[model samples]
Target chain A: MGLKKISDNTYEIFEEGMNVPARIFASKKILESVEKDRTIEQIKNVAKLPGILKYALALPDAHQGYGFPIGGVAAFDMDKGIISPGGVGYDINCSVRLLKTNLKKEDILKKQKEVVEELYRKIPSGVGRGSRLQITRKELNNILEGGAKYIVEKMKMGKTEDYLHMEEEGCMEDADSKKVSERAMNRGIGQLGTIGAGNHFLEVQYVDEIFDEKVAKSFGIKKGQVTIMIHCGSRGLGHQVASDYIQMMEKEYGFQNLPDRELINAPIKSRLGKDYYSAMCAAANFAFANKQIITHWVREELVRIFPKVKIDVVYDVCHNIAKFEEQIIDGKKRKICIHRKGATRAFGPGRKEIPEAYRKIGQPVIIPGSMGTASYLLVGTKKSEEISFGSTVHGAGRVASRSEALREIKGEDIKKEMNEEGIEVKAGSWKSLAEEAPEAYKDIDEVARVVDELGISKKVARLKPLVVIKG
Target chain B: MKFKFLEHTADVKFQAFGKNEEEVFENSADALKEAICDKKKIKAAEKKDITVEGGDYESLLYKFLEEIIYLLEAEDFLISKVKEIKIKNFRLKAVLSGDKASDYNFNNEVKAVTYNEMFVKKIKNEWVAQVVLDV
Candidate 1:
């Protein structure tokens, strides 16, 4: 497949065979940086899938992935399109959320080590780590069916207002527990409220700069103020679901017949597709609940340390997984399965999906940079609908794998560098620190610049890490 | 034939070069077992038959490994040694034996197997399969 440079920061994957002439928005420099990656091939492969509506899109942070590229966005006609677990990724609903606090940077710096240590102890980390609370089979079923709503309604962890600020209210009504296998349930039973390893973390940051004062104020972010961001997902249960469905789809859909088995998929109308969707949604809900429980835990830890510190959730968004949403294409409202793998939804202002309070300011897009770099807070724009399906880059896309990262950067040295840079770092294992070294990812500012220049999303505020806790 | 583990952003990859596909599959499973549990502690005292059905050879290989992972976690059975292995178009049947949970020395705990970087290909009349297991 030949790609043509349409603009300084954009490339067009011309329509060939089954594709609809896809377009990728990125800077010339960013495109050159990712040209050698297999993600380009994966994006073209996605264009060949059956019933792909509009264009098979990719964000600036795109990288090679299972079936689709990470940071990929594609919408398929719900009636004729196929759903592949590979598109949603193994870590279902792997997402990020920002919590605004009344405390300032000086306040956190006074007790940075203590607060991070307390958070590390309160939040379970590492692989196969389970939370302090173990759920019975019955409760697990409720979690699968009800999602975060169940926790707020039954467990009283948070209120309905909390869900209102979340994407989809932290639950998809289509979640069906019966479709989930027992083995998957077993994996999720004790994993809630736990932060798994590998690129997942909870960082305490300070507002370094405000790009859009209106949007930043709307998100309750003020310069020099403190905030905490949680990055995690459904844990083992989501992985099992992806595995279970990938095999099932391979058999039911005859993967060999497809151009790429990695893109193995079943029509959304098929039983296998429906079951996977239901199970995937359930896993996504599990992630929402997991984060909710973690929020409560963080609040508890804050109360223990600084009783005066008050923290409120700004917004939560899922970067992975697919959702059924209505988008106008060719002046017709059509239902499409929007697959956002390693991407985030950036609904512009006045969009009904935005929370009532945020309806005037657009959806808050939280883009977390690497461990040491600056993170950003952006908002959706109307132009995003024309380019991406109201989607944007999730984070600083990886430039190196864990092995490569470890080879080039040492964990202890990275920790030392972060400390010297005025950022406190703590992790269950040093290996994790090296694996997530800042050098492993692209400069997030360039990624944000591409989207901003393309009018996809507007910058709201920039955040600098004060303390990072990794599992 | 030598087998080594290759790490990815999301999964643990294994590259095994062998004289034949069967040998590679067997070694791939062995490499995965070594990664999960200590081979020395897994005694061949118990015998179990494993069969995985799939739509193609690659998917079959994935399911086959997934079955082994399940047995290791659910029954604490490790594949210390491979007694027999059989592969068809869409099915992998194996006869394996191992002991219960004991002192195990393992490098990385594979949480699950993903469809990422998963393929079975035939090159120069020899079969080679590459799989990335989620760690």
Candidate 2:
């Protein structure tokens, strides 16, 4: 509760239990909503964790999650720190991908209904919806290790350009399929191209506005150009991996000294910790492979509508993940484990971690808002690395609970409203739509504005949804 | 009659009650079933037995709820109800019945059970368990 306004857009809390101060980056308006929940407390608890380097941070869209607040970021010293499943979150590599198409808004408007319907039919979505592309358990292991690269090169689902545009080249090289448990493998074998329910979606959108023309051109975007965005994770595979490791960690290292049971972790150098990292990477690779397969389907479905349509990968970003990266810690560059939950890596220009094509312009950070809202495309700034360890908010954070949204909104009514607004909407169930109504989330434009104001990630373009496919 | 959902920002929260530990565990399974689908619509066409061990009562409840998720994810079994349950020395055994998940509509995807604000306790006359599910 001992929060101090450190600067124009940052707050720091240093209490008795904290080893380092917990910092929150937000405008005054966003801070008010953040204070309404336990996000502040969660971050403070994160600050108490062992070997935490710098301070625990919450972004503008920070919201209370189970152990660590959603939109949380923290770095830990590899030697003395711990790797927590709660920090990386359950949906390992829950990410977003953008595809820039040559088609214009008018081109999509001509056959919006048919396109939406075709996409809905082609892509398996919703709870318990199995993928159409089935693979053997051995093939699933290859995907777990090979990631998007395997899908692009081996499966021939996409081109070299596809994986090149993704973070980590669409695969974490350290991913070891053997580290993944049998139960996790069973859950994932049939879920490669499926989008599970609960806030996962694929939206057909068009560029509404461009603020940085040069950067927008580099990212292959223009005013009125159509772009498709896919939002999903590794599906059941990722979920099971997190559960498997969380239980394993709890059994290996009891939570007696931890602040919360969900915050249970093992030393980074421990065998158990290394195994989790490898398993986590494997799960993340599955997500990349999953999205790649879906990309192929999306292309197949859209090409039928426009034979000449050209779709290229703009970028793909994983918000829920942990990785080892070199950062300047106390005037010396050292590799530390950075955990980003409900946050995106916004690496600035010249960072070797970025794709070669965009390395000079910084990583393309894609922030997809709730359905029917305006999403933003931003480029990372140098200030982001200095302030928030090259990270930024993921989306318009949820402000209301699912039950409250269900109680107040009707799915049929929401569909009608979206239709009137010229957005084609398709979903597996009416209840799923109601639970994710735009009103249940904070205003995305405002959330983006706060980050832009802080210079963490500068906004380049805004996208308006033309069609929404929800699971 | 046994469980009711509570409010949480980004997940599902619920509390189940019973007269004893076994009854509470059964109702908790019912609570999980209700979260996935309409339990009445699910017929108990198949039955499977589950066994799990934990360090304490709280973890025992956690593992029990997680088995429901594992069944739904790995085995494609949507547990309709818990026909029998028993807990001894931090270990649990139960008989569960349900059909394939593809047979019915799922309202939401319950990703994984969490220990965040989880509890299992007995108060004066009633046994209670609290859980928060990540969806």
TM-scores, all candidates, are 0.92, 0.99
Cα lDDT for residue A173, candidate 1: 90
Q: Which tens-of-lDDT digit does each residue in B68-134 have in candidate 2?
A: 9888988889887898888899889999988988888775899989998888899889999999999
- Please compute the TM-score of chain B alone for each predicted structure, in the order given: 0.85, 0.95
Query: After superposing candidate 2, which stretches have Cα over 4 Å from the reference?
Result: B38-40
TM-score of the A-chain for all models: 0.98, 0.99
| CA lDDT of every candidate | 0.81, 0.92
Prediction 2 TM-score vs. true: 0.99
The CAPRI class of candidate 2 is high
